[model samples]
Target: MSQPDNPLYKTETASYRERWIGFIHGLQDRICAALEDLDGQALFRTDEWEREHGGGGKTRVLSGGRVFEKGGVNSSVVWGKVTDTMRTQLKIDGKNWFACGLSLVIHPVNPYVPTTHGNWRYFELYDDSGNVSDRWMGGGADLTPYYLFREDARHFHRSFKDAMDAFDTGWYPKYKQWCDEYFANKHRGNEMRGIGGVFYDHLRPADSADADRLFSFQQANGNAFLPAYLPIVEKRAVMPYGERELEWQEIRRGRYVEFNLIHDRGTLFGLKTNGRTESILMSLPPRARWEYDYQPEEGSPEAVLLDACQHPKDWVK
Candidate 1:
């Protein structure tokens, strides 16, 4: 597919913060629509009030479909007094917060392809005097393919890396490594979630001069999502496969479930912060299988992919 001539870029406006919110909402709509069109499944969204936190969010979920195994696209705009733990983690004093963001995950039914995730957020902290104190940006996109596809992996990585390199060459390799390390299953001796994708958090403007640069970087990464992922999905979604491959996919999905439930910081943060329960847990796959001490036979294609997951590749040279 040819790249769109009119790329989405961040613009400096008097209402920059509002524009960010609008951008996230627009992206959420676009991604959900694309997935629905490709997969022939409609997302079921729940508009529920968070009784625990006195806020509300819309959680869109799709499962048991022809194309998607399961997927969720959700957005929450919550406000309350920051907890002690949050203050310490954010390194800010006691205050109230106005936080808003969009989070999503897509799990395709096919084993040959990859599951993907992307999230972007804007936050605001207000001091006792109700003056804005600490504000920052965070979030990223990642890929998790059950079966290895080297060219697809390279394409995905190169798309994102080129986007980052346009802003700063230092970003792609650094964030790519960070993505690999961040999604690792430490208990399993650092087995990665998938081939690496860009991840970053808690980014702030270094100084007056750096603000525009940082915004540019974030925008570029955000706009790269379609190019980085959709092509891979389209290429692999139709590859013929047998029941053995499907079973193996479920087995691998079990590992994905383990990582998200046990080790994902996003999961923990959402759960701990009184975020929406269903939306937070929607990252889990629809079906997964766990076997006691399961190991693929040596020299099998499945085993080869597992070995590669254990040791990630340099997808972009």
Candidate 2:
């Protein structure tokens, strides 16, 4: 969206940009620390990189852990001139564009511990004079469990729902539906990537005060991630699993890879906009397999997981 013709757009201050950047950087530190503590045997290695066209980012990855198999927590602040590709693909108009966000994906060693993804971001479209013509905020967190744990699904959804209810009770349901729809393999009969969590985007604030409110909302969701996920990890990480479970987990991870590579807007957006290849694709699992015409036996645990993926259920009333 563009509003270069509107004189009022120039009056808006961009102070929130710095505040958001600060919040995400701090969040990266906290999350990395917590994950390291959880693994107790692995540490995240940091890679600070600069974008050739404009801004850069910090990428931290952990692998070969006691708990986690592979994980990446990344924060990026990037800016560049609006290009024809952006106009044609992203469908937004601006002389310059700025975006800052934090995105993460965690894959545990145990198949029982669900893989999770979370993102919180802000975008600004600047006019020819560097005035803010349009701005908005977006992002959410979701769960992708290899094995269906109804209680874990409820816990993940309720944690985010509680965070959203503090602002607007309506948000959790709306975003939950969005998450279900957004993270699906439409080509594969609309099967969901996971049970689902909360997702929202294109949140444009009405005023400076409203901007502050949205910032708090984003922060609430960001803060909710640990509590939403870590307890479930604690409960499941030590559960006994065999070759059968591991095989199913890898099979399911194939679908996760399919969604991210094919249908994920964030991944496509990053690659199209000259974003770092490694950071953008870090959401993929360390291992995956696509077995042709795979099917689980009737009334089995794998069948249960497949049923949930095909038909989403309300995790919280």
Candidate 3:
């Protein structure tokens, strides 16, 4: 999986931050193109808006695709004063701040394959005198599949593992476990979303060595997306599906909605801070249904799959 040479890498005078933004922009464009091509139907609606306080973002949403029911790829470069409530939550001393980042969520149409969400962001704080006070980087990717695809799960996990291994052998298992734990629905006795994907946040630059290591890790994971996902989508998109599968998918989507709305910190932060409503809610499935205590028949493959979603596996092994 050789990526096309990134032009941003060749720029000599651009600051690291500038280069990062350029890279993100290019990546977003490429992803949107790939998705549109694969879907064979143009479903994306590009949206632009200004923040009430200062800056804004571009939100690209695709819905009613042949493969994906709905998905959103959005980027925001926003800066504003941090309220006292925010300071309390982040546990930082800051009156004003600047934050910018790219985030995306892809929800596929097929019930067999999983849904995925990821975001990478940079945040900085400035003193009243305009001097840099504190800064840190945050973000990670996670996978949520409705029905299990063993090889697809293996491939997804392996790609992420390779990325983490480049930084540290311990990183893959550690962060993978963190992802499993983080996305759990505690109200439902800690039922997990999917098997797992690497997740980390609140990373700050240490010495040069540590800073470089963190940057490398971010790059590796960011680059891992296509290999982790595209093949799985290709394999499953054309597979025959029945009404039962669709029904099960909708039921599981209900759980997905519950987790995002009730438990996800990212969703909470976005809504609390006046983030774009459509963009924030774009992580939801295109269609979903909830039936009281609905249970698939015992010993059925569908039931087995639902059991697997509730209990993860060692897919790489």
Model 2: per-residue Cα lDDT over 1-317, one tens digit each: 23443222343554677788899999999999999999999999999998887778999999999999999999998877789998998898988788899999999999999999999999888888878889999999999998898999999999999999999988999999999999999999999989989889999999989999999999999999999999999999999999999999999999999999999989988988899999999999999999999999999999999999999899996
Pairs that collide in candidate 1 are: none
Candidate 1 vs candidate 2: which has greater TM-score? 2
In angstroms, the error of model 2 at 140 is: 0.5
CA displacement after TM-score superposition, residue 258 of candidate 3 (Å): 1.0
Candidate 3: 10-residue stretch with minimal lDDT: 1-10
Best by lDDT: 2
Q: How high is the lDDT of residue 234 in model 1?
A: 83
Clash count per candidate: 0, 0, 1
- In model 2, the Cα lDDT at residue 277 comes to 100
Residue 174's lDDT within candidate 3 is 82
- Per-residue CA lDDT of candidate 1, range 159-221, in tens? 888988887789888888888898888988998877778888777776645756666676777
Question: What's the residue-level lDDT of 149 in candidate 3?
Answer: 68
Each prediction's whole-model lDDT (CA):
0.76, 0.92, 0.76
